[model samples]
Target: MSSDAPVGARPPAGKTFFGHPRALSTLFLTEMWERFSFYGMRAILVLYLTAAVADGGLDLGESSANAVYGTYNAMVYLMALPGGWVADRLIGARRSVLWGGVVIAAGHYVMAIPTGWSVFAGMALIVLGTGLLKPNISTMVGDLYERDSPRRDAGFSIFYMGINLGAFIAPLITGFLGERINWHLGFGAAAVGMTFGVLQYVLGRRNLGDAGARPADPLLGADRRRALTRIGVATVILLAVLLVLLVAGWFTVDTVVNLLTVVTVLVTVGYFARILTDREISGTERSRMKAYVWLFLFAASFWLIYDQAGSVLNIFAADRTDRSLGGFTFPASWLQSVNPILIIIGAPLAAALWLKLGHRVSTPTKFAVGLVLNGLSFVLMAAAAQAAVGGDLVSPLWLVAVYAIQVAGELSLSPVGLSATTKLAPVKYASQMLGLWFLATAVGDAIGGQVARLADTWSQPVYFLTFGLASVVLGLAAVMFTRQIRHLMAGIH
Candidate 1:
């Protein structure tokens, strides 16, 4: 059978990775290392930004640093759309993954250069590379299994573990190296991680069979040329705009961040408008799309708060929390490991709980639960901030408890949101649905970055409490509208 053939249609498998195809191991490890580098760098990004110049840091104020962090995250996710397009139209997923890895490694290496400009330049490259790798790698994983196979979900679950494992370990190592030694050395560690991932991926190429070897839909002949031309033109226009901004003295970091955030929001709005106004969509699909709008808003809100772990929270750990451990002060970034570890321990339980609940619980209700949980996490954070007032160092347990609650919220909403995105996708726009799902994150991160600016100006407790209460109120509103949203879902659970 062809490599594209379903698992059930193929002859009995000879060797397998954990009773599945061997290719899974390759994908798993690749993802694990990619995440290791990604999270490792993220753990220290803000801390590096806000660090003193004497300590080989940028000395960006907290507000600008938070904005930069948010904008960077938003860009990483936003790039996935164009990244997916490039894979589909120009290169196959396999080559995209390969090239993306190469670029990512280069980006990390650039960050290791110990120059002020190098970090920003390196971040730009990483954003581009991650856009290429992130969405396409997940696509390749899906290619390993047939659409309807029961093993497909199982494969993804295994893949998910790899992601969490990487995330769980990255901070401990990178945080220690970055915080105790030079920040650039910590970045170098991340580079090594990505390099290992790339090397192993190349070595394991044989196991991949034909998965992602070719584009699902390739632009041919004139179409390909036209697409390339458009890309080139867009790049030129973007560069021109940057030149104008710089020459006009409007090219500050905050200005760039705010501009990108606006762009992300506009893209999301435009995408939804296109889908909703399409004449081709059936009424049923339209209703479901409408329901998805609500879900999308809820998800965006969740991530706005959840993803702040690296930025606002990281700063909090550094400035407010006591890290001293018997004359050995721990790196603040080490605390980042808490979320993924909790997720690793809690995921199976969450999965089992959802399985047990079955159809009795609706997606909207789960999302509502997530929102409330997320709000409560921040509410708890409010107390933590309150304790840290008057320069009193609070216990690290405060952040731990907060991350635990956020992880619970993540467990409830994230996977459910993915499933719902697939279910609610109109048949005509099926592939684009995943892009839309990612957009929700991009939108949230972009706006959240802006929202985080308030952290620098407002009292920490008030800031946490205001957002926390707002989220809780939104969750309660979601509870009130569950029936309406469900009816609009057109029977999709």
Candidate 2:
């Protein structure tokens, strides 16, 4: 799928905005609006559920709310596997993203109806839509560059900025609408944001050109057909097993959650094992791949905490923080902007730090540092929880502090981890490798949702403390293992 055309391969021959192509602007705005819809809806979901039944919520208990939240977050990430596959094998990335946006917009609109089943259905559609949009958009960014282009990292950074910008603004807009008028109104606002993104993508289709091209059909030849048959057989066997488990009363929601977690972990481990066992892999490559696996686990742990921005953090801000400013109490939904707002402020400083220290530290080392920073953010949150003891309002500054620190950790780790993944992936399985990375995040977010649901009758302080200690311990352990990883990444960069 290498393009002979030089259209988006270079910097568009001679444009002058940071020396990048204008198509970057189109993609940036599109991603911004998409994230606006996502983060905005996420900001209100838990609050809506737990908001007294008198206030029109289904009034789900803590565990149930958290369970649903976990399942929804987890499934969103899982669906990305099929989403990426469809983009690679069926429709191109552009089309997949466009259709995905439509699906998500509908989901949000359904959510605005304020019904129980509609909430479930809306969440499902949003999950599926995100699965379609998230992976394809990033892949399209990579497509904007030719192989070995230096601008790729910078382009991704710019794109990441778009993510924060949307995330930063979404809470302010939707949170206000939700808390002040009706929660459904906020959901409606998110739908409007997604609608704008879909329209932008349509208008900018020419700018995208053939960035997301479909691969040749794998079912065309007999050899491919046989391979596909084996895959289908395996799928059938797995489904049959699941059905048996459900009938046997072993497939409760908890069981399904555990099963999904186990299956995803096993598959990821198997992929790594295969790579390591293969004699074809050079020793250096093996070392680096091992490092990549460690980074994966580290990232998984970090997100297990970080993804709480939606579930746990939302409740904390709503219940504990002093939303009162002068005469009026601010909407709790506005607190959802904390993470993204911090990212917007801190990302530039972070980008500058990387540039300054690029030669001093390896990517794996940066990841190690990032995990520690992320762990520290939780510690700060625990302190906030401690301060909020005995039903008194704690300062919102504590929340702000936690967000700032976590954003720092995100800057250090996320992009670098993705960069490392690309470098270490075997050439033949590049797309699959990226899929696995995204999948790990899905697993982590699902776990975060579960953690978020623990607020019912549990002391929120204890929860934050437990999570904080766990993250710090894991971060330190990852740092201790950094030498081996450094050896792995020695030649890749």
Candidate 3:
């Protein structure tokens, strides 16, 4: 099984990049284009829906549009689990990446058509493709290095740069085409990007060698039969439910998005219950698990707000923020670039802060600060809303300031949370713990989508204040319990 082998263990054959496997470039380029397409479509999705009918938009109601947008984004998150399952149990990661890219390109092309059906159909395809691609690509990234290789971290860091680079560039190009010119053309551009990604992936396939060439876990004949039977049953059940609800006129896209939110929360709860009750776990492991539980909550809360950068914030940027600078105007999609830019600048400073402090600050404390900062960003948003009440475009700097604060919150939480998860994971349940951690983002995005569906009905001030106060309260609660959580961590941090 590929799982037993260290990724990228084979010696380089033909070429290399930065002293690592040449395959890194293939995987890197593939992921870059994938993100480019994803964020590109995302940058314009809300804007397109809200634009006037004369402007080639759907001219949908704000509530309906926001709901669909949230649900599409949430579906992308919700599919990751099943996607990973399929990759590990059915096919290899290599094939998964290839097929996922193909599907993604097709999805983009579907969205390029100027029709109602194309909109929903395109989202569905992208969701499925992203699920397949997201987890497996990172897995292949790890596979590109031998076990404990120093080059491993550097390799991943470099690959992640591809992600940031793609995300940063996507909005500028696609946003301009979609918002300022033609929406279909913008989507067509995404298809071209993904098409290029698939082509490059094919060209570089050999560089991967045996990594992810086979599933880590293969189902035996009987097990495969049982699994298929269960899947069939589940599919039948889902369709039946969908049919009934659709006929009843209660199965709108927003309803589906909200249902996914419930599913995410339930799944996370089930995971925590399973680990805490497992008899095989050690006493110390159990304590660490308790600490993880709180950390998970705080992290989820932070993301619930931060993930709005794409949905709510994107909308705000397009309709509310002033994008002009002395006669030069910019696309709203360019606002998305602020996050990666800030992350790039602040990452080293954040690392230095931790290093200089050197254990003086506890893990839980750092998380709490992040949550508080997350809340503050929303407060700033609330202020921006207040300023815009008179029907004038708010300054772009308002959004930038909000992002700057949230990025600090992000840097403090994201890396530290991952590290803490690794330390706290029980040996037997290590992989599951990691899965649970990823679940946090899925859950956050799910909830964020649900909240964003309210963009129409809720007053801007009320909406921002509600979430802002909730985040601050959660952050303060985390801070209050920091000592107790530290005790439970049993010194893992």
TM-scores vs. true structure, each candidate: 0.97, 0.87, 0.94
Off by over 4 Å in 2: 1-19, 148-151, 216-263, 277-280, 453-458
Ranking of candidates on TM-score, top first: 1, 3, 2
| Candidate 1 Cα misplacement greater than 4 A, ranges | 1-14
Q: Give the lowest summed-lDDT range of ten residues in model 3.
A: 1-10
Q: Which candidate ranks first by lDDT, i.e. highest?
A: 1
Regions more than 4 Å wrong, model 3: 1-14
Question: Per-residue lDDT of 328-385 in model 1, one digit per residue for the tens?
Answer: 9999999999999999999999999999999899999999999999999999999999
> Which is better, 1 or 2, measured by TM-score?
1
lDDT of 2 by residue, 1-493 (tens): 2111223333333343366766777788889999999889888887887777777677766566665666677777777887777666666677788889999999999998977668877887898898888888877777777766888778878898899999989989998888778888999999999999989888876666456644323234676577568769988998898899979999755676667666656666776788778887677667777777778888887888887767777778888888889988988878778888777777788878888877678776777777788778877887888888888888788888888888888988887777678788765555577777776787687667666666665677778877787777777777777667677676765
For each candidate in turn, give its C-alpha RMSD to the true structure in angstroms: 2.3, 3.7, 2.3
Local distance difference test scores for all models? 0.91, 0.76, 0.83
Best by TM-score: 1
